[model samples]
Target chain A: MDIVIVVADAVRASVGPLGAAYALTAIGLNLHYGYTGLLNFGHVAFLMVGAYGTAVTVDQGGPFWLGILVGVIAAILLGLLFGLPTLRLRVDYLAIVTIAGGEVLRTVIRSGDKDSLTGGVFGITQFATTFFGANPFPEGEYGWGRLAFTERQLWVAVVAWSLVALATILLVLLVRSPWGRVLRSIREDEDAARSLGKNVFAYKLQSLVTGGVIAAFAGMIIAIERQSVHPDTYLPAGTFLAYAVLILGGTASRLGPVLGAVVYWFLFEFTDGFLRGAISAGWIPGASSRRPTSARSE
Target chain B: MPADAVFAAEAVTGSRKPDAILVVNGMHRSFGGLAAVDVGHLEVQRGVITALIGPNGAGKTTLFNLLTGFDRPDGGSSTFDGRPVTGLPPHRIARAGMIRTFQLTKALAKMSVLDNMMLAAPHQRGERIVYAPLRSAWRHQERDVEERAGSLLEKFGLADLRDDYAATLSGGQRKLLEMARVLMAEPKMVLLDEPMAGVNPALVESLLHHVRELRDEGLTVLFVEHDMDVVMGISDWVVCMGEGRVISEGRRRSWPPTKR
Candidate 1:
């Protein structure tokens, strides 16, 4: 393969659907860790629930909007389940519960016992046709040169970027407002916030639920973009990637996650393609040339 | 004369004041085998600065913690503003018109000074998640809150640093900020834990003045302090505590309690 074409393909995919999904996940993580100081290690659980919720709903012939609604609600419920018992006690409990919840969700979805509803190991597919059919971006290619995308991809891009904008705007407003100030106070010292008449536990639960719902939206978007939902789609590694995105973007800064997702995805796609190309050319034959990212797409 | 040198010549007896806003009866708290607070009866006068002075490990801080609902007492029943507040959560107690400042000055380090003040105001419609997105839903309230916060900051001599981060504030400034921030809640009663700790010599007079002003403004002030100068300079009534017991409750000149 021509090196230019390989690099071009990487560039094209970087800013497309993958970057948008990662942006959503990191934004949610920023709220959990940066603002509220919740040590949620199972961020992927929200995504898994979102994907499965939407997927199962649509597969059962539910409306696409209803599927999205179900996805968001499931995420909120999952957030409560993870937060209620842990938030009142200590930070360590949250970390343990979240990680456990994520693994349990993956196991349950992949198990044969719930094959009919969850589709088990084979997963669910064709849930995105209706989602894409609602798009109104017109029939044309978008983006320039190496980053060009077809009309279908452009539709997802428009919606994804819009959601990104909306989430960021809301975050900017919330963080600067009275509510945001209370959140920062809690992050600084929970006892102080409580002493100031702010219900620390309730505020923490709100933050977790909001973050989880955002992650859920990211999940549904990615699932629809890919037109399928696999049990392995939300592995623990996915949570780490979101953290990478968050760290790349400075914590507690507006547009941090968005900018971080953009830069990180480009580098990720570029390096993955470069390594695969070098291996195919027999340049790095002694080492394994396989990339772990392909397992995600398949 | 220095504000710390000014003395109040008021007099009051044990568990009896002209206007008692807080009454603690049969209150008891213990940590493991050690009792932290064991006051059989105590009454804090309304609209007066009452200082709880004790040496280290006297459970002064523990009493403040238990009264403010920061810690669960083994056994206790207290009333604030004629309502039973014992066993209520800290936030609930605050909402019921009582607020507190920490001993170490929890000033929300990363936030701006103005944001710290705004955090104390309750029932803000803009704080709701859905309404937060709409500027119109809370723009006027936000402005009002900022204005009130700005005035309090000005009163505390921190108006110049409104936009600055709380973490950058010195120990004295943080104490001032924490004190000024509580005023935004419009609390009827203020519980101050070691407010004079880590304060600068220059700012000490101003803090004393503010403590007196709280009483003048019809708000009750109960402060814990180890500084005798502060206790003497401002307290209308002093509740001297030692080893988890009220050694004496007396005024400035009437101190050196004969009961102990």
Candidate 2:
């Protein structure tokens, strides 16, 4: 493989729609684990609900805006459902319940019985034509060379990044206020915050709901960017990947997840491209010499 | 000054008790089969320094936990400032003007010293998420809180480390910071669990002075300690616990009770 192609792939991965989606996901995780110190290991549950909510809505003949609203509301409800009983118990309990909840939801969505509502294993597609129709960009390519995006991709990237910017601004403002102080205090020690007259349980619930809603929006963006929604896509690995991005950027800081997501995708794609190139060239012994799939597809 | 006069009255009569700021009746807390705190009756007078002293597992800390709403009493009721506060959540008890510090000293290690103090100030409008993102909504109140936190930190000899994380503070400094942080709420009463458990002698003196100052400024203090010197040095009244029961209570002047 050419080094130029590898570099281009990394560049595209860094700033493209995929990076924006992960940035949003990590930002939500930052709110949950970073500032609030909630042990939410099933963060992808929020994403799953967001995507499914929109897909089901649109599949049932609803408009795109209503689907987005339903998705956000669904995420809020999911947050509360997970938070209410376990948040009062212990952080580790929340972690257990959430990861279980995420896996449970994925299994349920992909099960054969839920086919009519969730499309089962096949997933949903073409539900986002309305989303693309709202794209303001004229039909043309945007950006340069391998980094360029078609009109639809450009529209998704623009909207996703704009939402990310808004979320960051909100976080910066919120974290600087007295409210943020209480969250940081709670993160430090719940008993201390409670002794200081903060409703620790209430704050934790609020943080969960807020972060879950953000994750839902991120999920909706992922579906729209791909113009598809699949149950298998909202896996626990995505949550762990989001955690990696959050830690890489710097937890508890507003812009950390965004920067982390960009760098994360750049490295992810660059390494993938390089390794695949090497594998096809038989650089590593005993590795199956396979075709360069991207080369053939392009 | 009134507490001083009350002390004099109590010293002379040995029976003139002031109004109780906190009253617990038949308070009982048990862990599995072991009764941790089983006090029959206890009263902490308003605007005075009181010390709770006991051996290990004597239930002094457990009693503190029950009174401050950190732990529930298996059977009993408590009233603070004439209002029944039984089984109320910890935050409600705190908002009702009763604050507590842990034996371990929760100083919000990751936050700045100033943030730790400012976080304890109650009723900030910005604590509401709706108001949090809008600076104009709570900026003025925030400024006032910052000023108050600043003074409290200065009083605790922590002003120089305002921007530093609380985690960077020494153990004694964390004790001081915890004490100062609780004061930001201007609580009418404070429950301190082992405030001097691991303090240097020099810092212990300053801590005793601060506890005394709290009483002088019209705040009630209930502290648990194993240190007899601290208990005898500052407490206006002393309550001794044995096997989860308050076995003895008296004025500080006659605390040893003249040997039977």
* Top DockQ prediction, candidate number: 2
lDDT per residue, candidate 2, A245-287, as tens digits? 9999999987899999999998888988888888887788887
The backbone clash count of each candidate, in order, is 0, 0
* Best-matching candidate per TM-score: 2
The residue ranges of model 2 lying beyond 4 angstroms of the native Cα positions read A113-115, A292-298, B4-16, B258-260
Residues A77-191 of candidate 1: C-alpha lDDT, one tens digit per residue: 9999998888998888999989988999889889854458888888898988887787787788777776689888888877888888889887888887777877888888898
Worst 10 residues of 1 chain A by lDDT: A289-298
Residue-by-residue lDDT tens digits, candidate 2, B146-184? 999998888989999999999999999999999998899
Docking class for model 2 is high
Superposition error at B35 for model 1 (Å) = 1.4
lDDT of 1 at B223: 94
Error of 2 at A109 (Å): 1.3
User: Residue A24: error of model 1 in Å?
Assistant: 1.0
Q: Each candidate's TM vs. the true structure?
A: 0.93, 0.96
